[model samples]
Target chain A: MPGFAANKVENILDEGIEKGGAKLDNKQIEDVIKSVLDTETGERLKIYVDTCVHCGLCSDACHHFLSMGRDPKYSPAGKVKRTLGEIFRKKGKVSPEFIKSASIIASTECNVCRRCSMYCPFGIDVAYMMKVVRRICHKLGVTALYIQDTAHSHSVTMNQMWVKEDEWVDTLQWQEEEAQAEFPKLRIPLEKEGAEIMYSVIAPEPKFQAQLIYQAAIIMNTAGIDWTMPATPGWDNSDMAMYTGDFEIMGRLKRSHFDTAARLKVKKIVMGECGHAFRSVYDVGNRWLGWKRPPVPIIHALEFYYDLLKAGKIKIREKYKKSVTLHDPCNVIRGGGLADKSRYVVNALCDNFIEMHPNREHNYCCNAGGGVINCGPPFKNKRMVSNKVKADQLIATGAEVLLSPCHNCYSGLEDIIGHYKINMEIKFISDIIYEVMEKPA
Target chain B: MHDLYNFVRGPLAWTAFFIFIAGSLYRIIKMFVMIKKKESFVFTFWSWKYSLRSIMHWLIPFGTVNMRMHPFMTIVTFIFHICLIIVPFFLFSHNVLWDESWNISCWSIPDPVADIMTIIVVLCIIFFLVRRLKEPEVRFLSTASDYFLLAIVALPFLTGFIAYHQWSSYQFWLILHILTGEIMLMAIPFTRLSHMLFAPFTRGYAGSEFGGVCHSRDW
Candidate 1:
């Protein structure tokens, strides 16, 4: 009920205006738009803006709307109508005060979840619309501190969490050591040339969830697959910069990631289950660098695991026996077309599965995704409320375990599940598989 | 008075017919052209099938997703849409035009059923309008355009109801109904109501094909 209230709208708007109440000179607004419009990316942004018809069909597709108790102000169409529409109507002459409000709507509110675009009659991608809004905010230096902090970390350290070079290798070694306790001969196989796979993960693996790295090592080593994780900066695949709309730093982060793989001379990159990172490496980053496709093919862990099972590289000792539901992370399921593989992986690993009613692309978002959680505790209460639909969906599944295939999905789902006290365990696919996979001779 | 009503109705009916035909076709065709312009020209029917399944979940019961989350509202909205769709196509006035245009005729609805269905649709519209105004979340979402569209739609039904009751001169009410109907037809292609035509294709394209790539395409 705390999250279901709409009373905060007026207060949020008023406080936002007051915080950024300084009137902008015409010259400032003119200068900001001029700087952005001068680039080739600006041309694409302009075309996208010109195409929208402002149909409100996308309103219901947003979880924020449902989570905010069906507030239209939280709708994707409404967000655009408030920010980009205003800016476009005013011919890019918006003041700094207006930009501040636009920043909150873009950064903290919309999750770039693309659900609204599905409901958009014209297929106008409102996710892209929000990203462009964030881009403007990024340029105006109005980004959320926590998310932007990650982006800044990416810029300086070439990883979202400021994971240092030595610390990355040390974490891998530590994980390998923990994994070796399971299989003494197991090696993490760092910098191994011509390896069949170059495994990558987001910076958080080293910074927070190193056990995932440990679990993956056991799976890879036990399965006897030829894989190597890089001992360098690009080793971290997660890019909060992509979410912050800092394409400059996003490209740099992606370049480091791909470069790490290419430098290792691996056949391909098999990345961990982080949706945005997958999008950055395989789509946005590649596009930013002017490649139609990733120069080196990048496979999501879903696809990689699916391939591993299909190829009989590993046999299942037993299927996980929890009644589990799958949480679809937007980037992989919708943006990258990996829904089938995700399902394949889930089915391969889980025994008793209760499919979430609106499973796959129609699945509700875990509010912590899109770097919303990265915005920090200041917005956590709001973030928790914004995920009400997701909580309801999970509760409806009546499953004891939730198997999210992507890292961001894991984080978001974990937060939502905890907030609701739904008595469900959240985990990655690799953890379950590692527990049950039969070791090769 | 009859002659004046005849003049107004005849021209307005023709205008409504042409607008409905031209505007709907133009909007549908624009969608096709846009799809053709995407990187790959091929249309994947398999993905389209998946999308169709999801959309049909709203209509057909095929072990599809549940609408239980907002059960009451979903049902109400569903009924409202069905009436809006069926009445426009199968009501007496539309059926008369159908006979004239194609020389194909269908049976008219029974009087009681027709009256109930019309009344239900009118009531649903009013209920929706009231909800939009009374709920703060809905109120924040409602635009002047939303209210204006509702008024435009309510006009034809209100005038027709008055004509049915014979409270106002039948000729004048019928003429007013015909005029409001014409305006709604013209506006349909340009407004959010266009989702009626485009929702299927949009869902299909994003849901099925794009579904494979990302963990969820809800973005």
Candidate 2:
């Protein structure tokens, strides 16, 4: 067995231990564990725990294991054994130190990517197991500082980036004005009641990548789609809280998002290119909020672009001339099942499309989603090292431009490419579509 | 000794069968009943078709998903499970016992073919053991129970092979084989061996979730 090497960097768990350890006694820990294991988890958890044979078939499916030189600790099954299995074996009599370690293992180590679930012969959702560990950690108040802060932002600002209400509206107006250079009367219509689509985006778009909003406005205007962006807080759809195991805040964020759409009375929600945000609305948050699905239909930008291109509303003037490859965002491709539609949109807009090996749903995660990157600057080195497999995959494609639709994937790919010194430019799907699509004369 | 052997071969066997069936059914029911049902938003026309396809994709030996990722293990596991089921149920000796006990018999594999399958199963168990010992990742996840399960699985076949070859006291070895077989049957619902009973449901449910809930392609 590989021993846990003491790293020089101050571990994230120290803070969790200091804060949660003072607040929680052993009895409190046991109470939390008993409640979660007994009430929150159901037969699915029981069955998965009982059925895993320790076959270790899922080892290769994880990028962490691959990138970390096949270290056993990084293996998906091993992570579960160390955390959830240990908890079950101990029956909740674990110490503060153990809980701190478990919290770190659950929050920072595993991305909860669900790739391992694909490889499991018994189809055990190991990500669900990690989520259970995270839930326990959340109850113990041991979540990572950066991600917990992001979750706090979600609670207070209804956005991941803490964009204020006025700043959000101002950013939209600025993007709309910039986009009017192409179509002079283009508008990012705000809260247009009974619009055909309510276009939502993550806070990072307005805060950092406002040009994406500009491009989206151009596409919506040129295609003449009846869409509206909300001026208020609910427009940001990304949910770091969902990743941080703060289901209460996640539920609130989802309710606010859906309520905004309901108030606007849009037929459906069309969100920007963000994978985790798509998962939040379409699956996790909706389930938490007691809806079988989103109250209104939710379509991702990949699907939205596919629809527009298929309907001949968005016509291409020229094919994207650069040799490009598509990185399938895990949530949208595997979790949401938009792989085929995403490919269709890419093939329609790009002249030369080179596919990464193991493309589509089988593609590796960018190591940024699931709030791994949101754990933020303190863990950047760890993130880069863990993404060496993805770096190699990108390099092997030999494509000049990598088009990843998800914002997290884009940021992660940028980090890995820079770290590994790979010569590649990362672009989003809309970037190419906006470039190639015919503009109104 | 005779009474104990008779009990082990007769009432004990029936007890194991009942426990395996009842325990498995209880587990399956508990799983379904405990999890609250949420609404499904599977609106695709191909939902059921894809669910069935996903199940088949994993079910078929060296299926598309397994072939790409785990061709060697898949082949060995497929063969091992087939022999594990077929040899126990359809061997001529087993059917002869059934005929003697219950006035019922079924078609049997030729003795030579059955013998070859038993050997294959023993080899596969050895392979699994070696894998657990050699692979750091596998070893890290494995516990004493895992090795014990493998040993129990291999016990009946090993003792039965020795008895068939008349290498020692056949009567002693025969009793041991029957006792080990019954022990394995009883262990099925309690141990990781529960996978034999639970795999179909777990794998199928995973398929349905991906196909019907996530609307994702299986392979």
Using DockQ as the measure, the top candidate is: 2
User: For model 1, how does the per-residue alpha-carbon lDDT over A156-261 read when each residue is reduced to its tens digit?
Assistant: 8888787888988998899888877777888998888889899888888888999988888877876678999887677888889888878888888788887888
* iRMS of candidate 1, Å: 6.2
For model 2, the superposed segments whose C-alpha errors exceed 4 Å read A1-18, B36-51
For model 2, residues A1-441, the per-residue Cα lDDT tens digits are 333322422264345445876677788888899988887777777788899999988898888888888889988998999898988999988877778788777766788878887888877889989999989988889777788888889999999988999999999999888878768989999989999999999999999899999999999998999999898888989999888788999999999999999999999999999999999999889888878778989999999999999999999999999899999988998899998999899999999999998878789889988888887776777788877899999999999999999988899889999999999999999999888999998
lDDT, candidate 1, residue A157?
Answer: 89
**For model 1, what is the alpha-carbon lDDT of residue B18?**
85
Q: Candidates' lDDT values, in order?
A: 0.74, 0.86
Q: lDDT of model 1 at residue A414?
A: 83
Predicted structure 1, TM vs. truth:
0.76
Candidate 2 colliding pairs: none
Give the worst 10-residue stretch by lDDT in candidate 2 chain A: A1-10
True-vs-predicted CA distance for residue A316, candidate 1, Å = 5.8
Among these predictions, the greatest TM-score belongs to 2
What is the Cα-based lDDT of residue A247 in candidate 1?
86
